[model samples]
Target: MFLIVKSLMLVLMILMVLILVLNLCSMKTFYDKEKNSPFECGFDPKSNSRTPFSLQFFLIAIIFLIFDVEIALLLPIIKTYNMDNITLIITSNFFIIILLLGLIHEWNQGALNWLK
Candidate 1:
């Protein structure tokens, strides 16, 4: 245990010294607008590169992904349906209930409405 601890300490100390040396040797630069701006064919950009994104689209996509993954997880339950295991059936039913509840909650929250 002592040898293991000593080796770990040596490795950590080496890493810390290397980090400190790299930081001390690096060149620091001040921010400049021209340097940061998007370059297009060595000419000034006509418009801003960054644009505002719609949060609604992101939320809907996330919800879709969640349900999609749940569907994938449910596929295996169908394959195991003939196993005649009560515990497995009960657990899968509970999982389906939870997913259904989540879907209902999202629907109530208007996440499924695209026209909003």
Candidate 2:
């Protein structure tokens, strides 16, 4: 058993060294114009970085995050659900109702609209 364990450790060390050597041997030294450029979100990163951000997209993202957190908050109530617990049910229901009202308010305000 001792010999087998020692052999396994030796094999693992050899394999690790082999992998490191192979990776270093295959490393690319070539520089690339496109590959090195920053991520192009809405405007060119290589050019002017002072491009105007879309506020409409930002508003939609904020609304999405609000709903996302609302779902996160609501999920725990599902796991703790008990018909005998009347107040918990009432409280969760009230929470859902409030979320729905907020959603409706956002909808009425046209904040949910994607295209102007």
The numbered model that scores best in TM-score is 2
What tens digits encode model 2's per-residue C-alpha lDDT throughout 13-100? 9999999999899856559776666778757866867878888899999999999999899989867776567878887999999999
> What tens-digit string does per-residue lDDT give for candidate 1 at 1-116?
99999999999999999999998987854587776777775545776656556688889999989999998998798676676688777879899999999999999999888887
lDDT of 2: 0.87
- Which stretches in model 1 have alpha-carbon errors above 4 Å? 1-47, 78-83
All models, RMSD in angstroms: 9.5, 4.5
Measured against the true structure, the TM-scores of the candidates, in listed sequence, are 0.51, 0.68
Position 36, candidate 1: lDDT: 72
